[model samples]
Target: MIIDYGATPPIEELSIGDGSHLANYRRVYASSEKAAARGEVDLDQWFRDCDAAGIGKTVIKARDVETTFGGRISNEEVAEVVARHPDRFIGFAGVDPNKGMTALRELEHAVTELGLKGLNVQCFENRLAPDDRRMYPLYAKCIELDIPVNIHVGINFSLKSSPEFGRPETLDRVLCDFPELRVCASPPGWPWVQELLAVAWRHPNLWIGLVAIRPRLMTVDHSGYGPLLQYGRTILKDRMIAGTAWPMQPMGRVIEEIRALPVDADIADLWLGGNAQRFLGM
Candidate 1:
């Protein structure tokens, strides 16, 4: 069963507005031309593509950047999708650390009351570092709730915030503080790929998510992503997770590329789905 670790479905709540913070993102990484032209995603077509690609389950995440950027994809909306299609989708809650105690309460509500399975945080978008003091409480709460947290660990294209907010090394302190927290650092931590691999190697609870990034790049020489293929087949084999981060890339193309990566059948299975199964506790 293949599980997409990160994705933005065609939910109206997930729509990107005409905001300055997302100007760069809108131009550079938002690849779905048709969706852009329509100012929305075609939900039916997205599901059809996932089905055609053999993606059994896709994790839809809510984003609550209200405090910093006035953007939010409510947890209720994500829960609604999961409620309607439990077998095909998983919901991850988004809570702004800037909300303080309210964020903690919202997280609990999302999991205990709303039935969401995990948490998603975009450090750069939130304008906070992963190791920032404000994020510590949320990390602790994830441990208490027993859910994994997917943190954006690589560069964020948004011109509003500095990419330094997402430097992979910042996660080192978080891992040291919350060793038991199941953290998935996503987009393969490009430019600092080796640093992320080292951090993941050091922390058994950390998982590397190949989201938003094209799998084919991992095979190219001197791409800096080569170590993921090398260590992913060996020491990091059991902790690598795959995702389409759809709307950024076609799901079928991402899946096909993952299947084509040069790795043993067992290792490929782990990257495609096996590791995600274990990570999500499916």
Candidate 2:
């Protein structure tokens, strides 16, 4: 639905590392190569198409791909724009959790100085998972700040050597350990939507989101998750949201992709901008 669980910023707007290029990874090589070859990498065109398609707002990450958020917008850059166009965007800080205290401090910068509403953390990139006890310190800071964390779920764009970090179930431990923290699981809900719904039902704060990752409702086998889709109809109708991943895909394609889904006007309203409006608190 139109919810924020910490998704990345517009990658097209970001350079490969100055916060654009991500860490050293093999899959990243393939992904980057593919992106470069695509050549449909203009940022404004993507935003324009989304706006034309009636897509509401986008969540941009402060640091992603960048080893230290290299070229594009830093938390400062994001803060400046969000402060100016607060209605159009929501800022989330992406940090290397492996950096320990520095990661937490960067998060503080996102919240205290940049005024970000939440975080989009790459658990796989940091050599950690949501369940890692060593990372509890970061979660502690999030709880104190009242911000939600969106972990990269499903197949990672940058590709990870280890899949353990991407498991939705790993978060079960985090949910049980810290009941107060709000976390959003993005994509396929892989493993199981029932498990996700069950977990969310158990804890009011846990959530699931679709951040330019496509929707399950559009392609579900419908045998198991039929009811969820039924209940999610409200969100499906009013809260559908999309992210182009910028240079990865043409912005027009993202809008077409949503339009291609089986959802009707009600769901279209949500996925386009309604949900984001609510999630970003716009």
lDDT of each: 0.87, 0.58
Q: What C-alpha lDDT does candidate 1 achieve relative to the native structure?
A: 0.87
TM-score against truth, every candidate? 0.95, 0.72
* Residue range with the least summed lDDT across 10 consecutive positions in model 2: 1-10
Candidate of highest TM-score: 1
C-alpha displacement of 202 in model 1, angstroms? 0.5
Clashing residue pairs found in predicted model 1: none
Q: How high is the lDDT of residue 22 in model 2?
A: 47
lDDT of 1 by residue, 192-231 (tens): 9999999999999999999988888889998888999999
In terms of lDDT, the poorest run of 10 residues in model 1 is 32-41
